[model samples]
Target: MASNDMIVAIAGGSGFIGAAIARRLAHAGHLVRILTRNPDRVRDRFDFPNVDLFRADVTDPSSLRIPLAGAHAIIDTVQFDGYPVENHRRGLTFERIDFGGTNALLDACDDQRIQRFIYVSGAAADAYSPHPGFRAKGNAERSIRNSGLPFTIFRPSLVYGPGDRVLTMFARILKLSPVFVMPGSGQQKLQPVLVNDLAQCVELALGGRGLNGSFEIGGPDPLTFDALIKLMMEVTKRHRAVVHAPAALMNITGAIAESLPHPIFSRDAATFVLADSLCDNSALLAEFGITLTPASIGLRYLAEGS
Candidate 1:
């Protein structure tokens, strides 16, 4: 029930999650402004008639004002490049971008005529947690709650779909290797929601259905990490030996990976991987009326071009 003319601005709209939301809103006839640091580089990606690319970096407070001005709502989906790995030398830590950048956006909203504020927080967000990514998200959530604007925060559990890094990465591994090297015991449960369904949730939140509160969003089925990998194999028709690396070895590998210039997996990333990410979506269903996609059906997308 979103109006066609509402102006919605999305921070990090060039990213995986943000781009999906931008496409969904723009297709619904909303004027979508996509905020990114390098607009020209990503201009070709957004071919929608209603989508406009605005050059803005959440890390730089001064760059945000004009892009966010006069928007009805601002959805923040910004994450530092090489996520879950803190490139501190480049100022790409979770504290600087996720937490600090969100504060900057909130500060910029002072006179921008902004109404609702939506944040795409993670399932592992915890203010009290020692993990940098989790702590940053949890702190950002706190700031959004205290921002005094009617807000909606979504804590999505292991979002997966086309163009996603998580499941797609696993799929690539499954295609290449006879042995799938998994970290830890692979018993941790996950309920991964489809990226499109998450985009629809944002649309519903934009319509003022689920305002002034936080919601945990997830798919209907919760399965163990081992089961998820098996499902991926089933969909792709690639069966492989599942090898679980010991926690100590993973930690050592993560530590070594963190020192690399563009680290893909770190101790923090491993921590995230080993944890359970299940959530009850009754509230999300009640508010957004979303039909959650199961892993069995959604994983079929991996079979394409394989």
Candidate 2:
């Protein structure tokens, strides 16, 4: 598990968080394999030595075998993107991607004898959570924990960086409108973590230090949703009036809009945003020796190409 001998297979490595992890590991001189359904689409995105983009799909257990083979460890960053109902209609949802896919990956890990597993989950993941996605993520976490493999689970809150969907969407909205909609009271807390920092933490875990159990990872400081929006606006050099909407109203609106081809927000995401996404990152800080990156510095990336 030394950095020099690391052959890490990353599921969903074409994604924002997974790609960051791939870059970090590749920079550390590890043989990085990015497993995805469409390898050609993501292959050119990585130019580092010892980096390979291989075709694999998490939901198809058979497709995972070749990519995951001969790897020292595997990192699961796979997540279903669309709304629950929409995704379900397309045969892709948290139940399939998060829960079923995770279980499939775990089975492959066992067959391959890859003991070190790193799962990038969510901060609000809970088995009993009202949000179906969160509950499905919780099911995945349970599978990882119970797999009897040495594992490190990182539940990051609102990860943002350049090209990130959430922050990028916010920047786009700020550019188009004079007024920004604050989903809820704008007082719900969030501890947004920088994508690079989270990647670094995963790299540390890949090196076989503190590679067990779960860790709730977040930024240096927790701020209200409104404060985060203000910081984004300032960094992006945009002036906009922030208006708050009730959580109930926003959820109702999101539910109606969820059937759209691309929804600004889904009912599940809106409901989760109403609650606090804060967590004590003392373990993430001390165990991984990560100096968490603050949003003030990291949100600058969101301004890029904007």
Candidate 3:
């Protein structure tokens, strides 16, 4: 680590968004320690000069010792992936990772005297939201706010990039399916931001621009679900028939699938995609002096990475 550089510990540093932040911060000369249950796996995913991998499972608060040690700030990008919100499987779920894990990290930060905390939440996060995932995110946000720590909570809408699973799923669907299926009239508004742009916002929070409050982050242009699929088709040079159905149909199907050991879609996924994810980034621009990325150009990476 450089003499003047500060050490930043990322709770989920090996994840898609967390890896981007780790790369950006490491390139900027900050020592970034990646805290995850599987440090060996993280090493396989990402490697950089100023980046170090440490074993720390947020669900197991005792494992956070090495990762949080001697850290100046903590960037929490930990979240539960996959469908159906499994609360018991490996003790990983929206409630476990988002709410419980966040509480654990906050307590650890307090113990370590960490100066700053940057949390990456979703655009539709609300404590009272009907969706479990969104509600968990909201609960996490509330915990961070009440922790009495200097913090910045960023709620980004539909973050996408080269290795993003959503876009990759779209590509896979277009390649395999006879017809492209879109839920809820394909009109749900989404302001998809690039993962890099969101990472930059986290970097800004570390630099002290966004502190003590929350900010909404999104792309320059907002697109509907149908338009986003069309754009993906255009990017991948795949021309397929498109079909639309009521969002209720997806929910019903997902509800049935939730009973299975592994489900392709969950009711939570249906509700999450059906909800509007639009956000105004004027505040982000004015406050941080950062320009948002356009969805059209941002989707280009999908083609190259595909």
Candidate 4:
């Protein structure tokens, strides 16, 4: 840990955005503790001298209090991977991890006297529905809001960078499927922000002296879902035929995919993608006193980082 530095703990710090935030804060001379379920899995990933890795699960509130006790700030970047988040004991859905786990984290936060809280929410969370993932995110936001903790809620558009699952998944599909499937005419507007920009927002929130509020952030330019796919094709130089998946058919496919052990696409994801994920980042830009990086600029990092 750095000398006399404020402690900053990040959940899910092993992943793309989390790792980026951890590294950036560490560079800024803060003591960063990364909490994750699989400590060994991420052991060698982060080499920052100021970062400490600890094993923890968001589902268990008891496991969090110790780490969060004296932290100056905390970031919630927890994600429930795969389509179905099965809960044998309570038949819980993905919402359990989203809302339940977040509430648990908040409860742990309640035990501490932190100055700032940063919750990394998605752009689609603006109009969430009963869909497992969507509802879970919405519930998480509500839980944080209800917690009354001084916090910053960041709803970023599809985040992509060197080590992003979003772009990587699209790349995978493009490589596998000869006909790229886009949902609902692919006209839904999406503003894809860079992981660095989102992390910077978190950093700014932390430095803003408990400004404690919510902000919607997006990329430099708006692109339709189909246009995004086309851009992806252009970037990776893939010429796969683009296939537009009707919403009805996508629902069926998503259902079938959900039944599988690990389905790449969720029906809820398709539905959210059908809706506009574009957000105005003017507030975030003003607060940070910096211009947001373009998603396309991050794509260069993806090419090299991959």
The top-ranked prediction according to TM-score is: 1
Give the number of the best model, judged by lDDT: 1
User: Which candidate would rank higher by TM-score, 1 or 4?
Assistant: 1
Residues 210-234 of candidate 3: C-alpha lDDT, one tens digit per residue: 8797999998898999899999888
Greater-lDDT candidate between 1 and 3: 1
lDDT of each: 0.90, 0.84, 0.84, 0.77
lDDT of 1 by residue, 1-306 (tens): 245678999999999999999999999899999999999999999986899999999978999899888899999999888887788779999999999999999999999777689999988889998998899999999999998988999999999888888799899999999999987999999899999989999998888779897899988999899999998998999999999998888889999998988787788878877889888788888888879999888777899947
TM-score, every prediction: 0.97, 0.94, 0.95, 0.89
lDDT, residue 19, model 1: 96
Clashing pairs in 1: none
Predicted candidate 4 versus true structure: per-residue lDDT over 55-174, tens digit per residue: 888887778887787998889887755433343344345666767777878888766887777888877673267656666787788877777888888888888877777678788887
Which ranges of candidate 2 are over 4 A from the true structure?
A: 83-86, 259-265
Deviation of model 3 at 122, angstroms? 0.8
